[model samples]
Target: MAKYKQLFLMGLLLAIVSCEQPSPPATAEAGKVAFNITSYLQQQRQMLETRQPMVLKSVATQGQEPEVVETPDIDWEDELAVFEQADLSRPSLQEFYTRQEQVLEDGSTAIEFTKLEGANPQVQYLRLVMSPEGKLKQLHARLEDKNIIFFSRRTINLSTNPQTGDIADYHVEGVQKMVLGDTLRYEVKANL
Candidate 1:
């Protein structure tokens, strides 16, 4: 009877210790779980800086006529910064999105990441298409931010030259609304 009591006490202590053990920290899996948007944009910025591509830019705000300009002196980093918002490689976001890959009928591959229901990530949807030769051909993303005082929704679309891997054209359009203020609409497009 004494031995049985000792064994039971030992089992209870073991169970308590096991239950109190800390869990391991979450980590992103090795090897490209998601497309590295920031790296791609950095490469694009470097290439643009060296080559100084001509850009045709158009901007419109609040229902006004779009003003267009052709220039080579534009700031590449500032222009491409918005696209970086779609990056989902953060460890905290690893489980918040659902990723899917499908091959298109045109011999291209499409990969997408979408925010799961009940997740409050700002980037709701992101899609990337690659050509048969594994070159990025297009990218699209939808982002939104809302609070008691301000709300904004933006959609970004980008097309690239598959062979050269250069940005061919890109568009960003959005709407913003503030509490007790008029809503504003804006659009920006650039062709390189």
Candidate 2:
């Protein structure tokens, strides 16, 4: 009987550590997660819930034109911005929109944006988008409420850092952090 009690206590202790919940998965709706996606991608200020690579893939469908997904080979200096009011609020739609890359980034691309709306101007949102070609696309947003100034005043940025001397491909990391508010930071690092 004493042995049984000791075994029970040991089991309980094991459960406490092993059953610790993993961080929450990041969603495209808001840049938030419960866990880290990877150790290398982890950060002191933020954690990656997801990482996606960028690769154009063809779609096969019946009774339709063969969808040959091709990211236009653009000259970094010549490709004029073809989109107006292009928004990253919608993961899929924004992915489609960015398909016409002014330049091919690394295996993956990350973007952040603030001041998003759901059809109505009054509705505001925020998200950090991650696109991994052929695998998965991800997004994360903060716990937000509509009809507030925080949604409209926050700023977001997306920038790419090209490897010196080589511009065709590079790494991308950006954050959609709101000053004083819940700052959702997103950044990634990968070996070449």
Candidate 3:
């Protein structure tokens, strides 16, 4: 019967529509970001393994994500507290790298960066603090002396060699905050 045939076709259509797969979270734009993050991570790991002072990155991030997306919340001051307790007497420099961890959606992620031995002089180091959604909370960088400086730019990022003044394209607010010693603490937020 025509009525039965129509019902069968409708059911088939519904089934097909419902079978469609959801889009991947890692889109083309996100893919580019993932590539950059992976590259940075690899380079950081290499530096840690080799005990090298990473060339200061000139900028922060270059992402394809829409500018309107909500910036994730971060508590940079607390993040900095961790580095304050950094163990200077650790046997190897990489030991500092190993102590770094960031919370991801599923579990947690570890970030690596290059640190020069006594050449840089500050015992404390920089590391990435993260939110549960894999967004960066704060950025940690080493200062030449035994102190670290931080700024309260809630939704900003920096990418330049403060000492050398080499400019890199970092998408952030340019408000400087004083952090003494050899560590530089930055509050990296999701928003601009």
Candidate 4:
């Protein structure tokens, strides 16, 4: 009985530590950059919730004809909902630092984050570039298995509404190669 109670308490503690919620930024630039990520995620989530229609173009790496599907016919909300959750506070991001101050010709900054130790699936690193006002301009992420041959990378470039700082159009490109399988490549471009 005592052992059972101790085990339950330990499990609860682990869950609490693992589920730490994200906090807002502490500095002006950091806050703006973080806010951009949060806002973009929230917008994506809202789009999913509202079931906004989109045209998705998918093609194989072997140069097959792209398959264009208008989204209301095939619900893609379940897939896009995942991106709505992208935030600076995800457990996978650790030791974020300002790697470069002038990533853009206009004197914007780029922040880099090292993957957390023992992070599941192993992310190599993540980078976010932002405008002076803290609007996100681009994001890049790489994932790799050092012990094996699997590797993947994703990049997102966004254009925002100057007045609202909301994403106006964005492009996402990614490539993945599994340890025991063929490589896959995909790209998405959407405007709002």
Each candidate structure's TM-score, on Cα atoms with residue i matched to residue i, is 0.80, 0.19, 0.23, 0.51
Q: Which lDDT tens digits does candidate 2 get at residues 49-163?
A: 1222232434333344545444433222212111112234344333222121211264654444434343443213333333343221332332222343343222222222232
**Model 4, 83-110: lDDT tens per residue?**
4333455432433433234466777777
Local accuracy of candidate 3 as per-residue lDDT tens digits, 1-192: 999999999999999999999877443422122112233434434543454323322223334232333322323334223233332323343433323334456453434344544444343344554434454344444433323444332222333232332222233322344665332233232211
**Clashes within 3 Å, all models in order:** 0, 14, 16, 0
Candidate 1 Cα outliers beyond 4 Å, as residue runs? 1-32
lDDT of every predicted structure (CA atoms): 0.88, 0.32, 0.38, 0.57
Error of 1 at 61 (Å): 1.1
Q: Model 2: number of clashes?
A: 14
As for candidate 1, its clashing pairs are none
Supply the TM-score for candidate 2: 0.19
User: What's the CA error at residue 14 for candidate 3, in Å?
Assistant: 2.8
As for TM-score, the candidate ahead, 1 or 4, is 1
Ranking by TM-score: 1, 4, 3, 2
Ranking by lDDT: 1, 4, 3, 2
Q: Which model scores highest in TM-score?
A: 1
